[model samples]
Target: MDEEKKGTVHYKGAEGGWGSVRGITETWMREVDRPGALRTLERQNKPGGFMCVSCAWTKPAHPHAFEFCENGAKATLWDLTSRRCTPQVLGRHRVSELKTWRDHDLEQLGRLTHPMRYDAATDSYVACSWQEAFEGIGRELRAIDPGSAVFYTSGRASLETAYLFQLFARLYGHNNLPDSSNMCHETTSVALKKLIGVPVGTSVLSDFHHCDAIFFFGQNTGTNSPRMLHPLKEAVERGVKIVTFNPIRERGLEVFRDPQSPAEMLHLKKPTLISHQYLQVRAGGDIAAITGLIKHILAAEEKLWAEEQRHVLDVDFLEQHTEGFEALKAHVAGVGWDAIEAESGLSRADLEAAAQVYVEAKNTIVMYGMGLTQQVHGFENLAMIVNLLLLKGNIGREGTGCSPVRGHSNVQGQRTVGISEKPELVPLDTLAELFGFDPPRDKGLNTVEACEKILSGEVKAFIGLGGNFVRAVPEREKMEAAWTRLRLTVQIATKLNRSHLINGQVAYLLPCLSRTEVDEQASGPQTVTMEDSLSCIHGSVAHNKPASEHLLSEPAIVAGIAKATLPPNPKVQWDEWVADYGRVRDLIEQTYPDEFAQFNERLFTPGGFYRGNAARDRVWKTESGKAEFTVPDHLSAAGFEDAPGRYRLMTLRSNDQFNTTIYGYSDRLRGIEGTRDVLLMHPDEIAAAGLKEGQVVGLKTDAGDGIHREVGGLTVTPFLLPRGCVASYYPEMNALVPLSHHDQESKTPAAKAVPVRIVT
Candidate 1:
């Protein structure tokens, strides 16, 4: 085959069966190989290795030979690559030269070797000792008006590291701690916190095994969260109904052949995953679908009341614990069925069928993801979901609860350890009392607010503990512009990314140890706690060798910077805690007594522990001390109907990706052979626009305010996506997102709803 033909990305030859083997071979032979690659793979099977560095799903510590997904394997391999990123190697290349490389190529170039600083005079980076880098960063931070510094945390950071980072920021008198979770699950946390007085989900992962029915809304489990597939597969084996609501029909929701199940090996049989019905909801129309279902349930409840039969809702609980029942009923009654049917793209009958499933089931679980959270009214959407579940008495039960599948492994733990920029005053007071230093009381900037402050020249320094902050945010131009104005920028990360390209007046890149790498401190190998999406607190110990000898653990880096930056240290014994992470957990135990009691001893148990909350029994923690129902409004983008050529563009994830991490171009389960260049559209719309499968087209927002994004020569695929809706992978169409566009309550960008049109 021609070189271009072979590298076409979308080309799938006749020998498709050997693709996995070929990819493994190619990645091993040509890409890079580690000294203890098999040892790292073996570590994944052990109890102490951190959660799959890929997704947020938590599993029991089974001693299987291998318990990782293909994408997970890829993440591990990529992290453990043989390539090295040394200061000498970086010295040879200019910043502009490195900018020319693709994001993947830059990361694949290898692991960061040592601390370095950017010298704009020479337009290149130079090696700097860790001590010098810390002092330089500390000088910049201490000199700046305390409010002018912003600190960011990545989801990949362990709970212990995040805790220390937040503590250091507090002592420095700046709370500007924004993180990856701010963009993904902030809405879920906000909505749930308002409705239930808790920020995390209610159920544990094991709860899925006991549920008779599972309702998945606004989630693409296979691509965004492959670990969820394990529970769904187990549910299928036990004959549990799994109904899904999404704009696109994901293949993982159709059928799955469990790699662990033996029955599939001999007969090559795949088990069905979708329930009796799969509803195709329009993008940004989840509220409408959920509202229609709630309406159906209300009617059913009325009929049962007239017949003197017991309904699903706990009438006594509603009367005593809740106060807005009458008002909630009035709101649901006033919502017209015609509007619901039109907006949802599902007829009343379709909703009734799904609602009946929820009503009839004795055990139920409702789960959602960013698709529901990244919207203009994402908070309201989640509030409506809570209302639906509350009607059926689903909250606070064994197998029945609401779950927001958090995007990052330890994001929940980060919050638990007080990583919030807007933390409650109580925690601040307690920390001050414990540390004997007055904590800063001023509220800090969120991710969006921090970027705005930076752009306006109010913020002079940016410190990121982990994560590719630049690539994760939207409106790339504005984000890059803000980053350039910084007086000093410091990033502690395992790999190089575009964020490093947006150089500041003085910039530093500090290499850190990956969670999968065994972190050896003065005390020996250390273990950190990560709270899974299900609210399970577990210990993770690294089993692989360090990527580099110079790299330090995130906690130690925080302590080192704190020592150099702050004066007198407040007598907290910073060096001691840095040397021993267990002391950090000891502080966590003091901070959160209800959950972290005996934190060190509890972590020794397999799968760790579940932080107990009262919500496990349907208790209302809302302002009224009861589950409150917020009315769902009918969403009809008023001018969309009249706009001549406008279409709704929904950002999607490819099968090979997991939020900000692009493993490769292929979406295996979607049958999208091997490329992310294809746009999924309804066939009728494609024909109407005079376009073919492999033609080039331009996509632009309705009224371009200098926000024009074009995906030229994109292959078109016919899918079940609704009319007036076009789907493309995210970060590609992320430019279409406006800087000011986000959920008002949660501050999460509206990546799912963008008005656009295709041009020939």
Candidate 2:
């Protein structure tokens, strides 16, 4: 906590109005000149412009003139910042000295202008030629057993880059392709695939317009995906009911004022009220909350059955399109209202009210975010939501379906193009036939597994396409130590991050062009494609010049390393593929012909093309060939009943940040300012813990895994969080979350529901 900085201020208004304008303007001015900012802004998300490097929220069919959001503007300007990290900059600072700087400070050091290699003798990074850097990485990767090498990717990667990176990893004889999705939406993929036969949301952005009722569970759209507010605002104006479920009363879901609209921004129009009904569920209580709603609906349907009246459950859809309804109905009926009320932090009346809204709506959409997925029973939470939807036949119908609002621009695209650690999911036979090499069949390591492997010395080499893996993953100290154990670590990035600071015995930083920079190759300026949260594949072309002449496109960087590592195969032309990304798409189409047919042709279409979801078409691809209802044996709240003064802590992103990238010290929407070192708690809980507002405290996990896990110097603040539930900024509080504490089925870290004790 900086004494000179101002204390937190409670903002009393809606999000995304004048405040967003100010934020975007301030970020743009601080990073780039007016001309550069204007140039970037004009082309953002437009035809021949770059895709937003932030959330995966899909673009509208008809995008606005200013299509970007406040956070999007920050991301663009941050990438196109004039500040450069040249050789002189590296020469001025040692690795040890750089490690002392904060994460945001390190990022502000600006973009890496050239490739650099760690020199032990000099104790600093020395500028290296592209050829030498690639060959050195190639030699090191080849020296290790391919199975011992882990290739990781961030969601920021383009489809072409992801395809090439995965292809390179496979050709080298391994499938250890872990990605950021493993940490974020892997639970959604796993649960949705198991229940609905697809690993993505069934509904598109257009569904928001026609849906009679929208249920938002544990998502903060205002900060995470601000652009989503537009449709939400429209839905509100159209008199559609919007219901929200979360521990915190997020201002974004409550109300929003469109900054892009002149009447709202210039004339100071009234903010659009968002959620018609808001239910505050306890942390890790999403399963219980959803189950409670289902329980209420089931009870209502049973009453109607006893009376021989009209039923709420879509009996026709259930009989024709689904299975196991009786089992689900029985399970819900057995769960008492007392347990549901205690676990979900909602009364029977409240749950019944929500259930009534669901029953009355002709069509409904359930949208969720990381809040629902980053918990111990995350998979179960998703399953319950799907069960509710299935009861109403919400699958594959217009204005009705499940939507998981994803983070990152191309996370879905990366997974769609085969960036998976699971070898069984990869089209091994198709890949072998297309590339003329036998693909590895062994299941590889996911993010958590890769970290453990590195710690145990099972993995010797680590390559990251993008993302600050150190700060992004749990068990931060352990992960940093694991990196040092790696024989070689390689990062392909646009800017400096903490991951680069945490180095291996042999470390390399390969500078790559940002999404906003033109990726000119031997053929011509290449356009890369991205899949939004809704699975819409759209082309993104960069009109701006490269940030640095030395910087290479991610595809080119991957190609260079692949060429250096593998022997020439006449069947695969790495150089040609790098020169023209269309060739990469051709291969992807061939690999998943039915799904990606006409991939190149569709890239040119306005607003791009949809990769048809079978579930969306009511075409169930499950073993039974029908949508199956899953029944949870038990739903447990994540808190200690015996441990006194214990709080259920959830890690959240501030409005000033996106993922791990800290844009500023202020979270204006939450009224937090000047510091990220604070905990949000209910006033009653603060009194119960004998803590005063603004008092510094320490948080320690009760995991007691022999490893000491604690984060100190956190200021406590009273907010509207549920009792026994507390919130803190992520990455800062990531240390409190144990690596072993994860969702059982998906292996995704349970970052949202860590039980901890507060220390005065």
Candidate 3:
């Protein structure tokens, strides 16, 4: 709110170290139980304690004393906040008044302490009993056609909770299960499953140990998953080559000093350089950049074979373990360097140099994140990454694979246990026999389709296991409008979010427990299971006290709703599942017997058991019986880069934020402090647009649909990026991404590549 402060301050320190410590201290002090918070933090990622409630990075076999990072600490203490959003606390503010509040301020109101329902006449939420809430939700579900309802889950839920949540929806007569993955990594799932036979990332944490070279694309690892800095730093210190391709110069890939390392924390000069070479590729230019890499690689392979009777590519590996090599190589050869340079915003020389790193390294691991996945050609982008790795036989080997750095805990696990839109992924026959009811066989609506259905009056009921749904979606304004039009809306949450204020005709804010807090049922203290981003399964038990006596665990809430909505069935024991979460795991193992074999016994393993990747063992479950090299007709999403007088606007997150949750206004590493309304642009572009630094401007996106998509009041701050690219924080910039502007196959919103113009 300060007119004088531009909110962009130059940062000169290492990624972690003191900056990380300060972050932890800020959140720790906010807890009423400061010492209790410290005690809770100590329990993170330990055998008997709960897993870190933030990022889904795996716990090491030999864990560290401090297993949490800056973001993880914030997520933990956020749940342990002293402030409580009780009935008396909430009643003081009207719905109209709360709507005007900032997303940060709304969450700072603290955890929801009781079940609350909207009072339409008063325009406020009043306290209601859990029983009353469930009964009302049941009545609404029964009234509406089951086809007109959706069950949405955030990545925050445990595997046990996601399983039951999906079951409740299916038994109620639909498979309309949409989740955060539908927005983030759905492209990875759709692409990888088709190419490699497995949907999840191939690399586990151990893969970093043996990797000779690692290529990172589009992911800002430092902020998204600070804990990942440890492995990357270790890899660098030991002389592993790291190459990065991103539109913006993300601080995470530059330098870092792990706070957990005593030697580094005590010395400012001990910062570890992360990337050997950083490429500023344009947003949505992954397709071009990767294609260019392949082009260089193919040229090298031909020269080597012709001149020296040698091979630059893994000729034997490709012959034995892969298919479509000749076709893919031919496709790469056809793409000219000029087009690659123009589209990628990188020179041919840079691509050649990076290609040399790839060819020279014995074992390489390639990783990408939402930036590549959240694009118009998202599915194609992922397929290309796989194609690149396959050329080197980078998969199904030690330290050689394709890795998707996932956001939030259990997001991947949720899909693994059946939170899916695709009907075929769910074992309908098995579920039918197990639950004594017929499971829906039709394909369900994804997030994008869910929004359209809601707007079209086809969807009347909605349920969210966790997350601020309306706030995280594209064309947020339209979705928020349709959200209020729903016949019923239910949110099982730990905190009050913007979605809570946007009430439906019948809205219920069902308070639920954070994973870090104790979850007790009839059997005793329950320990739920979480599958890390890379398919490692582990159990966690809360050590901290519950936020509220009235709040229920996510599993309990799902079971409660199932009981209220479904007719009494002897086969599906909702009460038993709630009382003992392990019962849910038993059912999950029955559904996925191989992956979850000996579920209960192996769950509590010291570092958790790896569910294993079939592709890692050179077992391709694909129809081809081999890893397929998918060749696209050409590079993907080409028109955006060539469009004159326009910039590719990417929606990003601040260091202090996770997903849609904003911890504060500071992004210390990027020199951002006190504001989230700033736009990151190159200095040359700022001058070219006739816009001075620190000047407020507006960005408008013309999707050619007659709908005006614009965001104003952005303070233009100069930063490193491609000439035609610009960046802004998410949720604020969600307006720029039209709902229709998404991948045709995956339906993942192209948040990284919305074409826009700066208007003075």
Candidate 4:
């Protein structure tokens, strides 16, 4: 194919099959030889092998030999790459020059192979010993109040690593444990905690086998978690319906051809049907859509009872286990069909058809992603989903519950192991009693809160476990400008990223082992554990060689800091716990006895062990002591809906990208590639706005704060979409989203729905 044809080729094939094989082959050859790549792939998701460093999809009890997907292959092989960013490379480039590079190019510069410190005198980084780096970090942290320091972590780290990081922060002083979960699923955590008394999904991967239908909201199953396609295809073949509620028509949900299936692969058979119905919900319209579904079911239930003397609503289950039925019924009945149709951009008949599917299924699941969580009314949005499920009393059933499609692998695991801004979420009292020291009780900053503190001169130090924070958040212009105001910044990472270039007065880059690399410690080769989205914990041990000889395990890095920063407590042993990660798990067990009791032992089970949700038994820890229905006063916006020319912008990732890391320029499935500068809009809307296809336009966001927020030179493309809605790639378009544009309750950046206008 020609260069233009390569980027613009429309993928008419299914999600997997030949397309997936081509992708895997391309990435494997680019990163490593086929033999080496196969060697690594053979162990991925196995009983004691390394976990895929991609999405938080659960592992089946009897996993397929080829459990990894294209995304997984890219992530794993990227770590096993031969490229290395040695001291010589760092010495050759200036920070200013490196800051101007593309995100993909920056990470492609390869892995960091040494402990490096930023030298402001030369505007470059120089090699330093781990001891010098740790001591300098300790001295700087001690000079400032512990509360002034934000300890951030990415989801890539292990449970032991996150545990030590949190323990180190608490021993030093505060509970400012901000993580990737705060950016993506904080709405799920906070909302589910209030409604169901659990901050995680109650359904397991096995639930797909028994469920009659699955409802997906805002999450794309194909690109985000390709391995999840197996169960989805199986369910579809077994007569289960898949109903999708998303603003875009995702290729993965429509059709998938499993590459592992020899019959289909050899015969070149047709793709398996994935979604029975795909509804394009308008941006920020999840609440309206869900409300419509509930109303249709309620009306149907009344009709069934009044005419045929039959009942469909689970009145017995509701009366026995729930608390706020009358209020929910009255509030939903008060909502009009006209309002629902206008807000959701769907006709009443369409919604009624979708609702009838849910009403007929004996057991159903509601699976949602950031689409519902990253909005102004995200907290209220989640509760509404639970209300729909509760109308039929789906809770505590075999194949019925809520599922939050957590983006990063083990992001939820980090939160379960005490990485949170809220001090009360973790067992501080037990932590204190076990660790023999008084832990800090004050609430620390979350992602947005931490950024605000940094810009306001309150937070002066940042110690991130493993994320591209500054580049991944909103108000890119302001955050990048305010980044240098800090005194100290420490980032533990496997590769170079944009966040490292925006350095502090005293900055250090600590290189750590990736999940695919063996981590040798005092106790020899150690394995780390992670919790999947279904609350199951699995062990991961690396087989690939380290990217650099100088790299250290995350546990060792955390221990080094703990030893340098704190006066040794009588109960906590930093070195010993890290020497044997089993000690860390034991400590976890003692701290949270109910969920993690005998954690080490249970992790040895064939498919690992369940973290155990209280809601599985209909146990509600909410204030009312039962599952409660929440009714928001009104559907709200993030302060920009009333303004003219304000189009709802949903920022997303291309197929070849993850969070903020770009692997390639082309998103083959979308048919627009080779560059991340195109904006997609409806053809009618473009003509109505006096714009044409291929016109270079800019987007401007004015929150009325008088700050100039604009991104220029985006080539407009026509696509099938809801009116008044446009889509763009994330991190590239993150500049248009201001720091103030976030969910009101959870404070998650509403990247799914930023209000902006197209400019010439």
Ranking 1 against 4 by TM-score, winner: 4
Model 3, 523-600: lDDT tens digits are 999989888888898899897788889989999889888899999999999999999888999999999998899998
Q: Where in model 1 is the C-alpha error above 4 Å?
A: 1-35, 61-65, 266-268, 634-642, 703-715
True-structure RMSD, every candidate: 4.1, 2.8, 2.6, 2.6
lDDT of each: 0.76, 0.86, 0.88, 0.86
Clashes of each: 2, 0, 0, 0
lDDT by residue for model 2 (1-760), tens: 1121133335676788889888988887888864867877877877567789998888765789889888998999899888888878977999889989888998888888999998878789999999999899989987889999999999999999999899999999988998998898899999999888999999987788789999999898989999888888898899889889988877789878887778877756788889888888988777777888888787778788889888888999999999898998888778888888888888888878988899888899999998888877788889888999999899888999999999999999999989998887878888898878889989888998988888798999989999999888889888888788789999999889889988889999999999888889888999998999988888898878887899999999999999999998999899899888999999999988887899988885667688889999998888888898998755753523425667789898988899889988989988887999998887777788888988999998887577888899999987777777888999888898888888778888888889888977
Residue pairs with backbone overlap in model 3? none
Task: Tell me the tens digit of each residue's lDDT in model 4 across 627-697.
Answer: 98878655543335645577899898888988898888867666766888888887777888898889999
Looking at model 3, which ten-residue stretch has the lowest summed lDDT? Answer: 1-10
What does the lDDT read for residue 616 in candidate 3? 90
Candidate 4: C-alpha lDDT: 0.86
Candidate 3 — what's its lDDT?
0.88
- Residue 466: error of model 1 in Å? 1.3
How many backbone clashes are present in model 3? 0
Off by over 4 Å in 3: 1-10, 636-641
